[model samples]
Target: MNCEHAKGLLPALLDTALPADETREIETHVAACEHCTRELAALRKAAHLVKELPEIEPPPFFAKKIMAEVRAASVPKLSLLKRILFPLHIKLPLEALAAVLVAVIAIQIYRTVGPESLRPSDMDPPRAPEKAQSREVAAKKVEIEVGPYQSRTPVVSEAERPQARDEQMRAAVDKAGPRRAPVSKDSDKKGFAAPPPAKKAPPAPDELSKTSLVLEKKAKQSDVETPRASAGAGAAGFEGPRYKKPEEEKASKPRELHSDEIGFTESPPPAPARTVEAERPAPRKLEAAPAEPAPPPPAGLARETGADMALDRPWLDESKKAGAEEKAEAEERPRAKSAFSAPAASAPPQVVTVRVDERPRAGEKLLELLPSVGARLTRKQVRFDRDVYFVEIASKNLVALVGKLKELGTVGKASVDTAGDETVIELRVEILGRPQ
Candidate 1:
């Protein structure tokens, strides 16, 4: 037999399914040919290896579990009619029957209590006597007038009421008249009539004087009151009586030219003065004394005077020199102080450092923790010694990353440093031996 023919029969020969003659032929050829022999040996070894594997008996519910999974994966082949006529659950049918029953009950109740059944005509009807009584009561009600401008007596007929209202409106309009009118003396006289003077009884001289004084006081008060009244009228935009000045009143007043009205008295003659004698005084001779010169002021007093003069006028040489020196000294003093004093130094940036000890397989631990920490492995570098591993990871949230790192391994020391707008975190992981 050829190698290919023997190879095809090999599996059947192992299972002992071939005829005796074919099996003998295949075994003989496989033994003789090197290629077929090696193939036969490899097949026998594979079969032996499979047979040697431990048999695992399935659990009691294995078949059921497999069937459930198959059902979940498979799509049910339901017909349209079958799907539409799917069996209703007990609860659904019960709920539908309940709803129908409630609807029937509601309909029965509505019919029993409907408007047709409870209408007044079907229950109780109004009698003719009630209509007549209501009519009489309405007729006896007298209409009462309402509103401020309405008359006390209500007008029953509409035709006469409008005419009366029109008359009243016309009367009110006529009474209002012109808003502004010139004040005339005739109108004033008509508005205010003077009373007739009463006959006075004979009075003593003192009583007459006292009466005159009272009359004068009253006239002054009347003048003052008149101005106040006129001012109020002016403020209200109404024209009032205008009073004349004293001169105008005097000029307007009529006076009688009689001898009794004016009289001039003559001056008395001058008297002559008597002459008196004058006493004479003796004369004395006068002598002229020489004028003495004034002493000069002391040096200190002169210096004080100069200083006062300088203070009074700072433009003077002494004051100007002193002021300029003082200003220059003040300017130089600040410069010297500033030169001696050092500038304040700014505070250093805060740095936090943390150390972790004896963490072997740190790289593996970091890789396991990367997903939990929400960090992406940017770059990874293994040292030439293969003992140290440098891992660069990036995370949007630093605090979460730090927390996750702490949970990952023993945190010997951890530090966070902030510089300007950026936060820098340094982590040093120590491996006991070599990285795996």
Candidate 2:
């Protein structure tokens, strides 16, 4: 048999599974081929080693212990809802008992202090002295004669009647030019008389004109005088005290000194003034000689031909040179690849280009992430199309905020910019379908 066929039967031969003919053939091949002989010996050694190992029996109650551990491990974790509901079992009875106690106390309070306290007292009755006196007067009766008699009206002459008397008095008043009526002697004796009307004094033409002129003059004088007086007072208030030197005051008030008044033996003669001539050093020549025109700058230091005017524009000369080199290499070959080529293979785009697509909409996802990340949306704008949202968020913990935002939704686009000391995150969210 060939070496491959004999080697395949080696394991079966060790186990004594091969038939007599095949076993004899394998044995003959092993005897002649050194490789096959070594392989057979290795197989025999492996079998012997496996057989020599001692068998181990399990300890008592091994299955029970294993089953107990599995049951403990398999116990499901408690969810928020389960934990919340668990407390209701103990709380419901306690709450119900508390409510019952409150109701009982309310009912007892109502019974003790209710409508009975508001009712009027029956023990005391109201009393009035005036009412009692009126009742006493009403109780006494006065008898009246009830004889049947003819009723007669008093006869009054037309000329002697009160109507005639009133007309006569009115006519007399008109004829007398509003003179007072003469009171009867009986009325005068009774001490009752109407008072006389007061007379108004006649007005003088000259007095009215003089009074008006006097008032006008007084108003003009008051207006003119007030400003000058106020200005003088203000000037006096703002002016500072005049400061006189001590020597000048002493010269002005010179007094002859007596022997006893003089403190010194004699006044020392005034010292002559000495003018100081400081030896000022010659002024150092601080002005440097005009520097010779600097040698023309090196080529590297010289400004480039296509320098950007905007400060923010990055210097792309190195990148351009590298791209040119790559292009040259590609051109030298038969196939010249374009500088901007398609992606190498079919795979997810690089992290720099592609962003995660959050499943939840932008606004809701940001709200969910705010508390966990401890971030605030300082500024936000929602698009009219309801498909995009732009938000500016600030946070001290930038790492945590970025991490939470990634988990909140698919981050379509994210950028970090700084404003003063705070980090401002600008996010552009692409709204997807409604959340589940």
Candidate 3:
């Protein structure tokens, strides 16, 4: 029944599309509202004008012509070359088919050949050319020296010279007797081999005078060899520029002597062999020989030794002084205490028995009063008729605590027993309820 609903229905009413009930609603709204009536009238006028308007007729076959034009516009024009080269319907399908055929053929080939056929083991190794093989063989056969000297000379350190001389002598003896069979390289190819010849004998002593004299002579020779070599190089007129600086020449020393250059490879003449006893019994005494007592150390040495012993532990002197001081202080301590301080004679423990009515109330009251007398409850016991409290307090506060107890309850049996050196007294308070 609002203006909006009426306006919507007004158009339907003009077209006779609305039902009677809806039409009645719009009619009633239009009659009640002037604005709705004006709107309904305008709608009716517009509908009537529309009904009177002449119909517009399009060109003959208009839909067919428009569709033809749209089709023509939508399709692109192809050049002769494009049309000839790119016949999509045939070429695209053929290309796709060709690609599919190629993939299928590749897959079939792979499946037929298998991955194992392409493995490295199945292929033959490439062979080197004849000239290269011959060159490699020649290289293996060629003897090339390694190290500072490009000769067969072996480098020997100063320490190894004596051992090498001894070894050469031993090798000479062995060669004179019987030569050992040469070990085959193939026998050691599997890693395990016979022990080396050098390990058979332990090394001989190196302190021989002859060996020392030989070593000294070789050292002098090595020292002289460097200056001689330099002189020779200069005398021969080396045209090459000087590569070594003066500092380097000064800093560098002569190279170590090689075993071959030092003549250690030559064996010395064999000495005459001495007679060897097969076995001699170890010399033993039938009886144990008495041991001789050692002579005492001299007086001066003993005194010096004693002084050193004393100096070694200066703490002994300090400790002795400290101990003497402690002893003196210990001796004077009693005298000082007797003179300046008095001994406190502790009184014996006293027991106080207190009687009261309403024992529980009286026990609680005693517990409250204990702190004032500097006392603590040592023990508490609850009996059927009475409650007992044992308290510990200082001897000086004994009299004060007894007086305070008299105020709490009756002091029935207050007694002090003789004791020795007890600073604190244990008090027994018995609170008894009155008989009903």
- Scored by TM-score, the top model is 3
Candidate 3, residue 400: the lDDT equals: 74
TM-score of every model versus the real structure: 0.19, 0.18, 0.22
lDDT of 3: 0.39
Per-residue accuracy of model 1 over 382-401 as CA lDDT, tens digit each: 33222222222221344555
RMSD of each: 49.9, 50.3, 40.8
Question: Whole-model lDDT, candidate 2?
Answer: 0.31
Q: Which segments of model 3 are wrong by more than 4 Å?
A: 1-9, 25-39, 51-54, 59-61, 69-127, 130-436
lDDT of 1 at 178: 31
Prediction 3 TM-score vs. true: 0.22
lDDT of all the models against the reference? 0.32, 0.31, 0.39
RMSD of 3: 40.8
Residues 179-241 of candidate 3: C-alpha lDDT, one tens digit per residue:
222212211231223211222211212223434434443443344345433422221111011
Give model 1's clash tally.
9
